[model samples]
Target: MSDTAARIADFIEPLRVAPGSKVRLGRDFDPRYRAGLKKREGVELLRTGVALLAEYQERLAAQDTYGVLLCLQALDAGGKDGTIRHVMSGVNPQGVKVSSFKVPSTEELDHDYLWRYARRLPSRGEIAIFNRSHYEEVLVVRVHPENLVRQKLPERARGKDVWERRYREINDWERYLTDNGFKVVKVFLNLSKEEQRVRFLKRIDLPEKNWKFSAADVRERRHWDAYQRAFSEMLSATSTPWAPWYVVPADRKWFARICTAAILAHTLMDIDPRYPEVSEEARNDLLAARQELEEEAPSGAAADPYAARTAEAKDEHGAGHGRPARKKHGRG
Candidate 1:
């Protein structure tokens, strides 16, 4: 790896939650961790990372053999939207799909918890970004058991151990995806309670951001300790070798976005997707097409005006021998 890349790798290493490791969120992960990067430096790194990410995305689409799923989970105002906007800004819109999961629709409630997410999985050669994802089943629902009642589970499925079962199920599902060509990348934007409070106040104070602050957000904030416990357990239980969770420091938006971009770029680097190689027949076909285009160029007008009148010819009767007159548009 280049020095820059090595530095990025080191920067994000601490964010990953190792599989089978116990997690005490406030004790272990620091929400303000910046990995020694200043604001301007982090922004510069993020810009570079986004460019590299775009190149990898183009190659990934051309390769057309693997897909990537980025699952982003966070509490209210944890900066999931900004992180997605910045981290994936440079990628092709055609190759990346961002799915932000809000409250479940009536139709969504009829299916399994993972069903909605399953239906939106990325096709080969594409990247899917899940803004909240199925992890909410454990995080939010676990925090508020009343929310679980809406799922309407059968008598057999209901138990104190249901969360544990869901964890195992999620781990297995992610493993299954990895067993195939799809890779699952999970990230949790770790925002401190105080930082979240500050952000919530900012939203309330700013007219432009007022719409982002909901009364429910403060209501949820009242359950901060409960949510933190849920997040801690969720991170500890669901993080696996196939789909480990990266707890990004979300207090500093610049550093968080930079770390998020670095982690994604590193994964693409590890995947090492490349543009597809052309076969001999395809190469010949490309060359033939190139030659045909060259023959119709303005440079060839001197040799055969009729054949090369492709640039800007205005003919009253049009070209003879079934050739059409050229009408140039802006760039053409």
Candidate 2:
């Protein structure tokens, strides 16, 4: 790796934290967001990493022994959607699936908080993406507090303890998934509040993007500091070696996407998937099938063997005829 690439890798490494540890989230870690990547260099790195990830996606699918769970978390307008779009554009859609979590359905609320997420787990040899995942329960609910009452945990524990317990539960659940066969990669698109305000305004001012805006977004913005605290705490509590969070600086959209793609490609490379080996008998059978298809006679009205014969005979007899005929026309 080049020095820049090496530094990027090292920066992402600390994001792989163990459960119960503390993590700091924000531009404090990456002060040079916009200055770090100019457009051309950023796009080049993003394209390169995405291409590698596309290959890794196919390899991971072929392996059939490991699956990747990519979770994306970010404040609104932090470029989570853009990261998924640009960074993962090269991956084959058949092997990759994206799940966008909104407010839980009544049925989901009835079950364990992790039930919906567990059901969406990637099958063997697949990549499953969570747009906004179970982390919301701890983050949003931790900030809003009132949201916890809806979860119906034991009445006695429905306070700060509830969020803490959920954190422990999530950590244990993730550990279980990792031990079983899942490679989890969580990314928090860390955009500055100023950038977020600009994006929100863009959505409101542009008629095409107006639908994405809502009064609720303003409500959430009021609790920005609270949400940040919750996010930091959640990251610290749930981040593990097996499933680490990458805090990608989102102010520069291309930079964030490239970093996220590189992280996933690196993770998938570790799985080491390859094409299945064929036996001698299988190879022979394949060759026989090919030969049979090639030797098959044309049938029904579609058969036109005489066409080939006519063309061959005409070519042998009339090689010079067309040239002379064309010369006479030109002379005339």
Candidate 3:
């Protein structure tokens, strides 16, 4: 890694939630932290990280041994879409899959809460992005306990400790995935109340961004405090050694994108995926194929099909309709 990349990786170290460490969203992480980088510098760093990430992804795909799952959880107007777009812009689309989780469908509601998310996990050699992930079970469902009534849980299972139990289940699930060659990187876009308000207003005022605004977003904004508490608890409970949570400062979009891309690039470097090696026999076969190709008749000669057709046309049509004909020649 270059010095700049190394510095960026070091910068993101403090953003990761230490295993078993308790975190208060507002106090533990500052949403406006910019690592002293200006917008132009941050964007340049982000592009650099993304270029490195693209190389790492190609190796991961060729190796086909490990997969990466990036889970993004945030409040409304928290910049999840923007983060995914910018951070992953340089990666090969064939190796990445993005899934946005919204309200559960009727079929999804019938199953356990984690079922839908489990089905979306990354396959080997792929990167899967979760826009709003399984953490919603703890965030949204915790904030609005009434939403759990439709889950068809046993009455006794809806006790005050339900969120705690769910947290444990999620941790265990993530650990299991890690053990099975899937690494999870969970990120929370920590947007401040004032910043979110400004972004929401932008959505309303900008003609092209009007579609992003919704009355539901305003209703959810009212429970920001509750959501923050839930996020704090979730981060504390599930930030394990295997699947660490990154609390990215999202007030400045450029800074946040740089942080996220740097973290992901560092993770991929740590995984150290490599292209699969070819065996001696396969190498010999490739050499043989190359010799055969080199021994073939030179291109544009009579042995070449397209060349033969052109020669026949020249012989029949006298080379050109409007120009003088030239003497026939062998391949140059």
TM-score of 3: 0.88
| TM-score quality measure for candidate 2 | 0.82
For model 3 the local lDDT of residue 292 reads 76
Look at candidate 1 and tell me the lDDT of residue 79.
95
What digit string (tens of lDDT, one per residue) describes model 3 on residues 1-332? Answer: 86755776689998999989988988999999987889978767877888999999999999999999999999999999999999999999999999999889999989999999999999999999999999999989889988899888899989988988999999999999999999999999999999999999999999999999999999999998999888998999999989999999999999889888888887888888998889999999988986676569686654456756888788668655765577669986
Report the lDDT tens digits of candidate 2 across residue range 1-332. 55645655664564444555666666334513654458898788788888888887888887688888999998888888888889889989999899999988899889888999999999989999999998988887778777777887777878547777887898788888889899888888887878888889999999999998897998889998888888888888777766777777788787788778877877776676787778999999988886676567565532346665797677766756763321234543
Instruction: List candidate 1 segments past 4 Å from native.
Output: 1-5, 300-332
Residue by residue across 76-195, what tens digits does model 1's lDDT show? Answer: 999999999888888889999989888888898888889999998999899999999999999888887777878878867879899999999998988899889899999899999999
Model 2 alpha-carbon miss at residue 119, Å? 1.5
The list of candidate 3 runs beyond 4 A from truth reads: 1-6, 297-332
**TM-score of every model versus the real structure:** 0.88, 0.82, 0.88
Each prediction's RMSD over C-alphas, in Å, is 9.4, 8.5, 9.2
